[model samples]
Target: MSDPLLDVENLRVSFATRTGIIEAVRGISFTLGRERLGIVGESGSGKSMTGRAILRLIRPPGRVEADHITMHGEDILAASEARMRQLRGGRVSMIMQDPKFSLNPVMTVGQQLIDSLRAHEKLARSECRQRAIAMLDEVAIRDPERVMGLYPHEVSGGMGQRIMIAMMLLPGPEILIADEPTSALDVSVQLQVLDIMDQLVKNRGMGLIFISHDLNLVAKFCDRIAVMYAGRIVECCKASELHKAQHPYTLGLLNAVPDLEHPRPRLEVLQRDPAWREALSVSARS
Candidate 1:
């Protein structure tokens, strides 16, 4: 088979604290192809850090170390800041958790989307506007022309998230790092956003890194699931087989989820194990 779209090895992220150095992402490794790969863990388990480190988004006082982070044979770590700028939205786009904080409060939706596209592509102003509206339509936004004139605050939460997705995809990136993209939306809106993302990824043949805390949601949406704990991935498996995961940490996570059909008196609490932190991260490269 051909090479994977992206490959990461021995990736670590750390921050300098007054006490000492604190590691957020402990030497985890994974690969992305033209498929959805889910990284599921509790908050502060380094899911977001891993995603940012891949794009070298972690700024100083914090450090990103990796043996290699390659995209199509080029090492992302070795790329210059200018090259990274070219890669960030042009080749790899990220949809942050909340659109409110991510979108510029001063800009209209149309300006942000058009600017994002212009940053990566040399298109005429008219062409950029047309593409932006078309992308909005692609994400199922009705009356794109009207929506474009509206600012971020004017749109509902669901529409804001959809606009963010549309803005990210306007660059035609080969990889998308979506960090809790639907966390802020209602359940129905979450499904709508996920369906939009799912269709887009399949249609564009892009690699997707879906970082989420919802284990059941990830299991349903992703092709494979990487169970992370204490900054390490303890288990990796096909999403369909997540129920059969062997790691104690993975089992604990699974047991903690509430099932509607099999209602239990109480959900199981995850008992933490110190050894899991010291264990090597499971590779999610298959």
Candidate 2:
């Protein structure tokens, strides 16, 4: 394999609290190529924080310190605000958990997407409108022309999510960080949404950082899985081999997930140990 598309070494994020300094994301390192990488953990386990740090989206009071965050050999951590703005939706984009929260209610879906397109490149208004409609159609949204005229509230949750995907992908970003994109959608729509994302990732050959708490979903979708505990990754392995993870934390998480085919009397509760956070190790499995 060649060098990674994105590389991270000793990335950390912390916040200043009244009591003391709180380290939300400890020293964690990983690299991403043109493939899917899943960061799976419970809430407050820092999976979402890791994604935010990658994009430099962590705001004030919450600090982001990284030894290096290189994207295609350029240091993103050191990039100026202007350069960061250009890179944000143009070079690397993120699809948030819910479209309702991420999309602007005031703007029509078409206008929002057109704004993104125009931000990244110069084009005629008609051209941008055409491209926006085309992008919506690509996400499996029927009647895209009508959709282009409708407000965010007029669309269903699934449609809203697809519109957001269309907007984020219109720029043809090199890397995508999806933070539990399908969590808020219906079970039927979940697979539909995932299929759209998977197809787009494959078609674009983009590096994907999929952040989710669902071990089973990530295992099924990602090539590599990084299991995170409190503020750090405890293990890294091939998604198919997650069931055979070596770390105690990984084992506990795997045991906690309910098996649908065969029901257990009681799901196992995860027992946390203080020593698990002492040293972070990357156990890469073939």
Candidate 3:
């Protein structure tokens, strides 16, 4: 078989605090082909940090150490800044959790979209604008012309997310990392955004790393699921196999969610286990 599209190994990220070091990611490893992979865990499980580390977006006072990080045969961890720039957005794009922070408030949506296309491809102004508009339409946004002219703040949360998707798609990336892509929107709008993303990823044959805390959503959307706990992946299996997960942490997480069919007196709570932490440390070291 051919090599995976993206390969990560023994990836670790930590922040240096006054007290000591806070390990955000504890040597997790995974490989992605042209398929959807979901990273699920509660908040502070290092899901977002893992995604950010892959993109080399970790800020100062934080340290990232990895055994290997390769994308399509290229050594991403060793790439120069200029080369990394070419890879980021052009070959691998990320859609942030919130459009409010990702999009420029002052810039018109059209300008940002067009700029994204122009940065990757040398196209005529007319061609760029046309492609930008087409992308907006592809993401299920009607009246692309009017919406393109409006600033980010002028549009609804769902629309802004669609625009962000358009911009990310404009780059024709091989891998897309969506971190809590629909967390800021209503349930109705969230489904719409996810459907658009699902269609695009399928049509383009791109590998997707979907990071979310919603296990139910992950089970429905992803091919495989990785359950993270305390900065490490405690379980990795096919989405359908999640119910049979062997890890205690995974079982705890699965049990915590309420079951609609069987009404319960109270919701199940997660029980902390020190053995899980010890096992995680051993796994990281190994």
Return the top candidate by TM-score: 1
**Candidate 1: Cα lDDT at 132:** 96
The number of clashing residue pairs in each candidate reads: 0, 0, 0
- By TM-score, highest first, what's the ranking? 1, 2, 3
Residue 54 error for model 1, in Å?
0.7
Query: Against the hidden true structure, what lDDT does model 2 obtain?
Result: 0.89
Clashing pairs in 1: none
In model 3, what lDDT does residue 86 have? 88
Q: Tell me the TM-score of model 3.
A: 0.96
Instruction: Write one digit per residue (lDDT tens) for candidate 3, span 1-286.
Output: 1578898889999999999999999988888888889998889989999888998999989898999999988988899989988888999999999999999999999999998888888999899999898888899999999998999989999998989988988979999999999999999999998898888889999989999988889999988888888898888888887788888777877777778898789877778888777675323111
Give stretches of model 1 more than 4 Å off: none
Q: What is the Cα root-mean-square deviation between model 2 and the actual structure?
A: 1.4
Best-first order by lDDT:
1, 2, 3
Q: Which ten residues in a row have the lowest lDDT in candidate 1?
A: 1-10
The lDDT, on a scale of 0 to 1, for candidate 3 is 0.88
lDDT by residue (114-157, candidate 2, tens digit) is 99999999999899999999999999999999999899999999
Local error of candidate 2 at residue 213 (angstroms): 1.0
